[model samples]
Target: MTSPITTSSLPEELAPVPATAAPAHAVALVAEVQPFPIAVAGAELEQLAHRLIATRWPHRETAADQGPALDEIRALCDHWATDYDWRRAERFINETGSYRTEIDGMGVHFLHARSPEPDAMPLLLCHGWPGSILEFRHLVGPLTDPVAHGGRAEDAFDVVVPSMPGFGFSDQPVTTGWGASRVADAWIELMRRLGYHDWVAQGGDWGSSVVDAISRRNPAGLRGIHTNLPLVFPTEAEVRDATPDEQRMIAAAQRYRATLDGYAREQATRPQTIGYSLADSPAGLAAWIYTLFQDVTDSGGRPETVIDRDEILDDIMMYWLPNTGASSARLYWEAERDVSGAQVIGAVPAANPVPAGFSIFPGEAVQASRRWVERRYTTVLHYRQHERGGHFAALEQPAALTDDIRTTFRALR
Candidate 1:
């Protein structure tokens, strides 16, 4: 009796509900908040499946350590063509009810879930490159409704998870100047519009940098900050007088820059060059993203070793379906140039003004010594070294990360 709404014929109810009204404070700055849902067209999914089937794969790598193994790519692509379910990922976002709001003339997509607890603290979770709102999907329920997730009612948080510009459902930055610092400013404005005067910030990877920037700014509502991947490097003296662990970490960082940082370097310098391939070829996009997952996760050697194949595919789909290859990569260009005056570049970052917490996940890109971290975050309120989990802590060790967040902010709250 009824047919599904095609992408071309999307009804007003399902479309991006425009923001006709703006708060008093928001009027000065152009802003528009709209109710957004995660719904990719059925035809887009069909196209993705077809592209996966028609991939023009490269020859298998002779050196397994150099890149993703052939067998791994083959298996992943096979599943992408057959068993992967984009709807499941879409359903999760739909259930959570995401929204898109214009801040600084750029559209930002975020999930704002409130807790029943009257005294609940506001928590903002920012994700990095290759990570969307999906990174914190599992953590949302536990953070918002602590009682349901085996925590005290007082530990509840009104969580806000925003997709950085050019990532996920958020609109990509049209002009330049949308680096980490600009994004930080946008987050503060977002919370202000939501009527949150005080909140804590958390992130890993690029998210860590953004949180670090926010902490530096010491925005009106920001209480404290936490990061899984603390962006601190050893000082010259510290490096010279390194402990065995510090030495090991320094070596790892050096190796990463020399070898594993090609993708990053390319993105930083020439994202548009690779953008064509990334936007055109589904297989290329998967491989490009999968390589990072394989290298960063705590999974013996491959990302799938620690995380599920389907989970990885879901993350990949976020990039592929949205055609965000170029836009996402442009973040690196913005970071490299410090387009927004708020990027934490170089080896040693400046000290944070606000209080900070560090959850040092073992599989992070590089390990920083307490001395190194203290140099950047003078008031290190809480510090924990996790035995498991990697760069993608929320996906790999949600319970541990969640516990760390709760414990880190208990005093502040």
Candidate 2:
């Protein structure tokens, strides 16, 4: 008779097996031999530029400054059609030891930068809406070699930057369940498959939600969690017993819901309908993503004060070339099922036992007060309020972000 396999007898590859063996982790992290090449040929980019230049823009009211100022859009398109360099960006990404692996029947692309330090902690960093793996580009070098960047080698981290499912090289899931919760499971399996029994997770935007799910679920071997955005469901007493700053923050959040959340609402409810408009027109796609960058900045009058034009365009190009505008937006659509319900708390606050940290950016929706975040997180080791960075903190202030990552993980160590 065949003997039943016990946990001790399980292969090292399955060292951190799931609660149920039925949820097998299929993806494997192959050994990194050399930097993976990504070639966005100059000619192809030129062709895209030509299409933009030839596009017949729709008419807008001359006096109307509503919804992505026409002049700003035109200027941005002109620069993209003329000055931007996709090849250079591709080279930058390739130089960082990027790679692709198949997970859950999807081809997932990620940047895997191993630390020179043998004892370095492994960290999985995720990005959110209107962002990509590119956000963490500057972070790879500093994180993998902290000593070289004015920090101790013990602060080093082996970083993994995966493009969320349906966002980049990762194949779009035909079915549902690729939401934050499912994505968290995929991330845990990814780390386990990579032979990391313990690791850290960090994210912003939709990534924050995914990180929250990972912590709440308390996946085996998760050491700690960090996020730029932490959504805490408020209680009646909390709302009733709010301070002036808390009340002001709540008001700002309410205003955001009223005005700025339309895209989210549509994405959450009718992504397919909205996707049709975004999938075809590159300019349309740029406008949609660009609007967010504009709305969520602390710049006095110019969005450029917060985000670089080329950097913003780089993120826009990911959506443009991958044709993921529609597919990626569907994540919001799938999330609506829970967000629209009367549960009040959206999804359950993760009951994660691991230590958690927060890096509060100035332009984020509303910085979740420490008291509020404490309700959901078991341990809050580090909380820093940035003076200037905005929604896209990784791209806007990479050096500062790298420092935060180092400081937070250093505490966990």
Candidate 3:
């Protein structure tokens, strides 16, 4: 019997693929990337002001933790209407960076920060639901210009933060099928379009899933991936034979799915239905998104205590300004019926052989033990647990996240 072609005697067809091999991209048309400096027309801001002012208030909840406190949201809205500056956020984004390209006829918006260092690494940052590229905004300075941010010049990265289609300033999808898998393809195409032949990616929330998807694709240019939330659902056996540490993680995830996941379920099953309330009322949208920030942050029920009120509002504006309350939720809708039958947007990850690293934040509801992570990521590069931070790592713990990214990729480089 003829032996299968051996690696030692491989012909051209059987030769190893090059490291820079193109990632699979199904899009039919890819247009030239253009400089898309964000500018929310003055009329748009006025319209938002009108919506915020016209909000119909809801009755107070008897229990404080039942949801966003009526007084809290009102106070937030009061400040949003009077003191918050959307123009400042707009100007920062415009001045620092902004770009958009048409992939499959859908406009993909991103912020590209080029490093001044000669041998800087290329990095892609992804964000998830209720989050815009805004999550990674703070990362621009330290990551792209590490020396200026109290880090070594060797750690500088050419960072690309993309607003997943239907979120932030990116155009909403006109049809169905914009799931994690498709977003992964688009991200790969994005890095390629920008001429990044070798690079790494980082993500949290939905961003984790995108990075997971890209890893599974094992595209040529993708050198490594780092995630704050790693998907390591212990097998039924692992659960049955759980260690003390493993049990704690499993229990934490169980508690989250039982109590804190109502919003996810609503978004997953009825994005359109929820979209109506979210799209029409600024107050409704803020409360909906705020519930997450409150529940997931390490702030002990007060997200504003941990994250700046203005920054929180800025994140909310990403959805409110673009009217993405409904559109962005569609990703959850697609994911519920998605890539792997076993993923929770904030819990699970794509299984792959790509060199992988993970940073577990203590307050993040969904997390895996080191063994679980090691089992899934065949080529584990780095893994560590942090004392603070939550699901919104980029926003809640930028410095730690930055340090972890630098450490993880240093080995790869």
Candidate 4:
């Protein structure tokens, strides 16, 4: 079985978010949205393969159950170098009709797929750390055209999947303050610019936090939110008189904080420090990210049980090809600083005022009981507990996640 892992102990500023403000140097509302396609240079792919071949691995984990085993990593690396077809992944992304637009001075890259149905609800999907837009790749065609995927046309959506700033192809912020709150504002502006006056929002991991921020703002056009990673922590009262489920979750959260969160601490405290290794070594980047995938997927022991090795590499290619190791990690640094207070060991932020829905998968890094989630999601339209899936819910269980989106939003709509 995979080792147990926990969510990042990354700090959040307890201070209330201020009213959304446009950056002083914000681009005008009429900023351009240009068509963009994925095209990594030939030499870069060659260089990556060479690096994989030249890798010098660390000694095997003394605790066999701890982190990725040495042999496992070597096999993965071998597959990456010899059999992974990044070109196929590139074709998949390009076919999605991606685009880049300037929002509040930062260039935001997004995939905009309109439904064949005349009247489809507009939905925005956000991804988090170690994840690129590729996380939601499988859900796009299914979400945008449900009819073709064995669903009714009425369930169709005009989907918008944006790469978070500093992640994927989006322009990385040179200065600070691109935290959760700022990203929430940027997403609102993005939807507005695209002429979506009313829409729904969804995310997992850091994306859940971003969507939570959006729900808090209760923006004009945001209809509701559906999050897979429901960041809900029990109150003091709930803790004192915990249910069996709550006690189990509380213990798990504690174990995660104590044992499996080193990467988060490093990233939050000093992204640039680790960025060096992540940037210079493809194998290092793969190993770092692979650890999380291995520990967090619903797969019994191996990540490949749920996701294809090539698909996993495709997600990594977003970081390797763009050389976004430093930039992407900067997001944690910015977030930790922006949300200044020390993160309470096992606490969810305050309840969101807007309508919300949560899907808690079995293998999530952080687990929460329904009563705990209901406290924060005051208007919880839906709350589900699944037997499978994990932090990468969209990628691991696309149909389940997509169905939740459809079911949750259908009520709100």
Query: In TM-score terms, which candidate is top?
Result: 1
TM-score of each: 0.90, 0.87, 0.89, 0.90
TM-score for candidate 3, residues paired by index: 0.89
- Report, for every candidate in turn, its global Cα lDDT versus the true structure: 0.80, 0.74, 0.81, 0.80
**Candidate 2 Cα errors over 4 Å, as ranges:** 1-36, 61-65, 338-343, 346-351
Taking the tens digit of each residue's C-alpha lDDT, what string does model 4 give over 1-413? Answer: 11111001111211112323432212223336655555666676787899999999898899966778889889999999988888887766656666677777777778888888878899999999899889998899889889999998988898888988888777767788888889988899889988899899999988988887887788898899999987777767788989987888788777768877888898988899999999899889998899889877888658888988888998998888767888888877887777632246456666668888889888787877778877666788888999889888988999999999999898765
**lDDT at position 358, candidate 2:** 87
Q: Please report the TM-score between candidate 1 and the true structure.
A: 0.90
TM-score of 2: 0.87
lDDT of 1 at 205: 87
Consecutive 10-residue window with the lowest summed lDDT within model 2: 1-10
Q: How close is candidate 4 to the true structure, as a TM-score?
A: 0.90
**CA RMSD (A), model 4:** 9.3
Q: Which residue pairs clash within candidate 3?
A: 231-349
